[model samples]
Target chain A: MPVTSSRPVCILGLGLIGGSLLRRLAGERPAFGYNRSTATVNAAVADGYDASSDLPQTLTRAAETDAVIVLATPVTVLGPIVDAVVEHAPDCLLTDVVSVKEQVARIVAHHHPDARYVGGHPMAGTAHSGWAATDPSLFENAMWMVTTHDDTEADDWLAVADIARAAGSYVVPAAEDAHDRAAAAISHNPHVTAAVTAAVGAGESRLPLRLAAGSFRDGTRVAGTAPELQRAMLEANSVALLNTLSETIDRLVAARDRLRDHGDVAALIEAGHRARTAYEEVAAGEVEPIVGVTIGDDGWAQELRRQAHLARVWVG
Target chain B: MPVTSSRPVCILGLGLIGGSLLRRLAGERPAFGYNRSTATVNAAVADGYDASSDLPQTLTRAAETDAVIVLATPVTVLGPIVDAVVEHAPDCLLTDVVSVKEQVARIVAHHHPDARYVGGHPMAGTAHSGWAATDPSLFENAMWMVTTHDDTEADDWLAVADIARAAGSYVVPAAEDAHDRAAAAISHNPHVTAAVTAAVGAGESRLPLRLAAGSFRDGTRVAGTAPELQRAMLEANSVALLNTLSETIDRLVAARDRLRDHGDVAALIEAGHRARTAYEEVAAGEVEPIVGVTIGDDGWAQELRRQAHLARVWVG
Candidate 1:
């Protein structure tokens, strides 16, 4: 609702996140869409989206209006998307909805120094993917991580923040490297952990495996995620994930040793009980939400530090 | 119905399982309920249960009526319950509803030679515990593991099986050692692994912990379980769990190495995908139900082995 011109918002890649972003921005702004699929683009155009017949035409219209370009493609296509956008729409403000942030931010910074690109990642998704599975309310009350490098422009940051807020998310400002590390620990590392736990527990025998009912099912639900997608995310952030996973395994082995050597797993159980309690408290809205995160203001960053302390939102 | 007298079914502990068993037996047969909680005993009596004033009186009346005694208590209480039941109702066919089957089965076999005891473990329960949480439909279509040692009598086994069937469960025949091993892999091992995972994932840094939403929460729901209860279960089956956890860690490390060195995690993802498919197949009722598990026949055991292959219900 903040003051802005009538420049259109163009979203590339009609995938789940892109489609969702387009649908959620309905009526808020003039939406232009592009994708690898012609049928999908036609479907969007039929639904009243401003559709260009091709990427060149779309980029031409967007570059004319100094539009906001949202890159919603996969990780592998990120570099190419940035290069294309810089070549065709140098005046446009750019951002991304990628899972991994540091590499994307660095690549953007190197590829087009004149273009202002804010790295954005919405901390929400389901096991499903593709345009058909897009949910307009997917970002409702979700944490939308907006990352900034040393050369990030304040105006560009605010523009992306406006879109994220409009999409019904709380803006969480983090450094580029911090976002990658955090994603590894929370999303990528635990993902592999769940898969590995289920696999080893599955074992070669079937008798005990059948007994893997409620608890194992709940513990390893993420293990059923599409393999190809999981592989990309895990390997993309392998450095941080490998570190977190090694430490996690060490901690688990220690717990195992406690049980085997001393016949006591009280310490392990107690620690889990404490951590779960803390997490539940936050989930239940027992902590205040972070709102209107300031980009470059010293006092604003200080306020962010205080909020992270109170809300338990640390810089990973 | 089977040409039996008016002998009652006596449930010794009146915990969740015992209470549920008594409630389910209502109108099908006369029920005699006993528990340490005199208040719970009175509540059951008020609700039309044939409640006993005390343990000795309960046992004496049960023995006089030729009752089938079900010892439903905590793991620590199993041995004592068996001793007391044998002392009072020596002629009755007895069984138990303990979580860990092998230890309880072995203890019952060693303590009282005259009493025919069939080891029982119902693979179902909520986060709630005790008499208040009892549900008559708790075991409806649930897997009820009935364990047998060499000394177990066929008549006694069938008596327990009849009760299990009446309570609406698929009676699965397994050796005492087999039941323990299966429970360790499926139930006990996965349980501790969840707790340990949650513990490690919930380290002091709040950044990543806050980002751990659905996947982490789903993976670690068992971590929020009561500390003392988890402690007892994890400690009780430490040997099997330690072995399983070690293997799981090794597999995870292999996946980590794959991600770090070769930039591949398909092996980890594939293993998880395969295991999850196996589990989901059974869960969706794709696998045939365990029917007519043979007791002692050599060909019967062979039939069970064949059914394991056909039904895809292998030993874990």
Candidate 2:
């Protein structure tokens, strides 16, 4: 129940993730939020939630209550939001729910170097956005990645992890750089690939689209996400995404060459089949969690990251 | 409802498509099928369905009844099945529900050049296959493509289309080459691309696998389909798929280069977004169906192909 603290949680922004976070935290702790749009604020308030349009007032109240300030805006808009946090609630334990961790960490460091900040990214969302699309159960059983570094404060990490767990997520501890790379491999690159695949169908005229069925729809599903949102995440983590995208392109080239030259894609199909089997094993709970890693003990970061590399979850 | 007579329908190979087709045709017509595996044959017979392991006797019965023989096995096994059909049911009206149209068209021409043949490719299936995964409702509201060639007889074409309509699907008429090319763009190439994408995540450490969420899962869902089945479809359509696969790789390379050199993916993302939106329009019933095309009229093949090219359906 998040340590039962009276130090309220303050959320800035009320789009899908932020709005959903505000609703999810309603009974767990004293939480209030601010959105840039007054209509969304009014909508939340009319629904009996503590939402406001005044960012300064929101941060001031949060500061006075010794709150945990959560920055919940797009990566492109994080600069001004971080400046607001620096001005009014610079001393609060800070966290964020952005998609890219390293970029958010850099924004926080640039805005207020001395601010007690912990980076967070909940690996959850849908194609929809805005407060109207928000649902309190959005994070239920999702993975919320809490980033760690050599100098990160253990207490601040625990505070954010507690909230993430309270919101019905399994907290995954990762380093900022590692999280961005992993996100690029699993999320951001696939978004670009999906977009490319979808554009191919569209470019082929409507005949291909009419013949399109499950594979085309499934492979290109993420391409339907709002474009600007996709840009924010993909551009924010462009470095890691480039490497992964190139590797993926190389694999395709090899498969193409094999098909053109030898008329065989046996190696490619076999590799993919085996990989999907491994994922099924892990998803079906065949991989056991690694126990005995105390959250605050010395060398815990190394141990936890090791557990993640092996696809094992942390029990604590 | 289908030009009712004592004529029966003979299905070869009671796998997913054939088994499901046999089930779907139960009350509509007199149907019987042959499967190579006695186990599946026994299972169907025990369930009171007309299934047999004797290919010679099955084809003999089909020949005597002036049946329509549906070749439902994978493309790799189509040679032997077509040979059996030629040996016993050479005069029967023939069709197939294979994934690729032109390949089966070539096989039929090779095995029985004078046979009454109309190629079919049903654009509906789950990732799962085989007898156990058979569903009677599999083809309900699905698109079943009926192929046309220069020498195709109108009665033969209508005969196959009627059976496909009876199986509960919209009948789309396309030329043999056009159907294979369209399938390559939408289905066959996507299978190869999915294999590459899934292998990328698997090639990475288990961390990426653990972090794989919606986009990764959706993009790679078909990669989990039976590898042998994937090979059958992909290999049979290799010529057309190579062209489509090459174009897809070019798009990815361009996106990757843009991301690497200019740190910009706006062009790529917008193209994909626009394409997906276009697809949504068609799937959402926004595109009006083309009317006034009389089936089997003069120039009807050209007209229907044009309608399909414009992403319009033929109502009658």
Candidate 3:
């Protein structure tokens, strides 16, 4: 069943994604956004957003109106955000935008069973982070993976899809393990490879490296990525990441051995060529889009607009 | 000592680099330029270049002038070019613009000891090849590695540097072995890796790769490289290239192991970050410029111009 009430949407942890969501909603409806960082909240307000730094106050405001509360905190903070949301807004449908689905699902299941929680991970980011990098188009053409288990309510899944659509993503339903494995293969493994390549090259004389041309720059450019976040993700999904990393290493080592022993380097080169082509194919969306869903008329949009208006009262 | 008369500058194989050299010398002096392909000479003439398809005609032109003959053909064609130059313009300083140095040096030693051949490799190119990509700035700010053996004279080395300087590169002297090893580590190995990475990514079914963000595109963009030329370089310098490939694989495997074993991924991430920084340092020339000597005097420039003019006319 679709959400019948015009509940204002309350977004918790207004960082890059949350702030961007608030900005997008502000354009179409009144939305309440809260961040632990006072400066972040202030910056959002300065940008004319309905945001607050106080979690309890924000949650109270969300409960008074028919609003869905989205937890946009890091994985470490997700549990606390859930507890706070449940305590303050028991009547609200709760969801999260964390990358890991299993952890969020378990937390929601154990603590917020009656609070209508759904788990979502939007596959989008920029080199830049924080509220400054938040843009509505960030989610455009991005995949929003929403994972549900056997205990997940049918209505809650639909509501999660609705939110993802509103955020401008193609909502794809996947199990937790599948999502984690796929992400490990594509995102995490590549990032690690980039880092390793950079490290090895850097170990060379710093002077010669300075003269590195376009190819070196492009191959190792991602090495400058945020280490903490990458570490966290790697640690969180170590099992799947380990498998993908091992597979990549095996391929590279085999190629190296072939070249060393004067064995056929053609097959090795061909494998790399094939891998790059496959990656390009997926990136170009030449394959089917991951998420498939059709909008149910404009009813959800109208309700979202009504909720946005009520949420505006808490903005000031 | 400088040549008593202007050295004749003969260019063997009037393709991109050869034709460009001929064209640049058009109004100033005529230089002998030969091409195996009759169509190339015709195209050069159409483009106002003084060139010929006949080796004897080009050789006769070189004999009349104090010229240096540059072999700008592929590695496989360099031996024949050296033979032609040696048989015709025995006194002319013979040089080449091939990427590999050791093979060129060996051929020169065996077949053209009296021809004063200096091995040259300009570290500059575009995705596009042929006469169309031949700009005078092709060697600007680029490294031109000049390899000389015990048999090569100081005068011949200086002349090779002069030609490279005129072509807009900073000339750096290296032994044939050093040049080959450096080229394999920086250029040839990277191409193979890029091709393999692209092939792998392209083989994926996740059509999300089709949306291959900027990083993927940038990383695998070189996969479309000319396979024939790449294969030749790999085969020619297989020993050094294999060594570098082994090193790269070792680093990649180490990183994978770290991630798999739940060891510190931080070290791996840091390595990548450092590599990128080192690359930037080299590209910015903050590190010492690798190749050519700085021609700080207008006298040297004028002398080069005068010699280039005489060589061009003799060849024409």
- Model 2, residue pairs in steric clash: none
Candidate 1 stretches with Cα past 4 Å from truth are: A1-8, A38-53, A148-152, A291-298, A312-316, B1-8, B20-28, B38-53, B148-152, B290-298, B305-316
Candidate 1 on A185-262: residue-level lDDT in tens?
667876877787777667546665555567777877888778877777777777777877787777777877777789
Order of candidates by DockQ, top first?
2, 1, 3
Ranking by TM-score: 2, 1, 3
Q: Which prediction has more favorable TM-score, 1 or 3?
A: 1
Q: What is the lDDT of residue B8 in candidate 1?
A: 65
> Which has the greatest TM-score?
2
Can you write out model 1's per-residue Cα lDDT over B1-316, one digit (the tens) per residue? 2423234688888867888888888778888788888888887777777766488888888898888888876766666777777788888888888777766666777777666777787777665666678889998877777765455665676677777877887666667666666777677766666666676666545756666666777877777877877777667666667777787778877887777789888898889888877777666765465456555555554455445434343121
The TM-score values for the models, in the order shown, are: 0.88, 0.96, 0.76
- Candidates 2 and 3: which is better by TM-score? 2
Give the whole-model CA lDDT for all candidates, comma-separated: 0.73, 0.84, 0.64
**Shift of residue A39 alpha carbon in model 2, Å:** 2.6
Compared with the true structure, what per-residue lDDT tens digits does model 2 show for residues A1-316?
2444455899998899989999999877899999988899999999889999999999999999888998898888888988888899888888999988888888889988898988888888888899989999999877788886666777787788788877887777789888888898888877887887788777556877877888989988999999999998899999988888888888888888998899888888988888778777766665456567876689877777777778775534
* Highest DockQ scorer: 2
Candidate 3 stretches greater than 4 Å from native: A1-26, A42-51, A63-71, A90-124, A131-176, A278-316, B1-68, B126-140, B148-159, B162-175, B199-204, B284-316
Better structure of 1 and 2 per DockQ: 2
| A136: Cα error in model 1, Å | 2.3
Query: lDDT: which candidate is best?
Result: 2
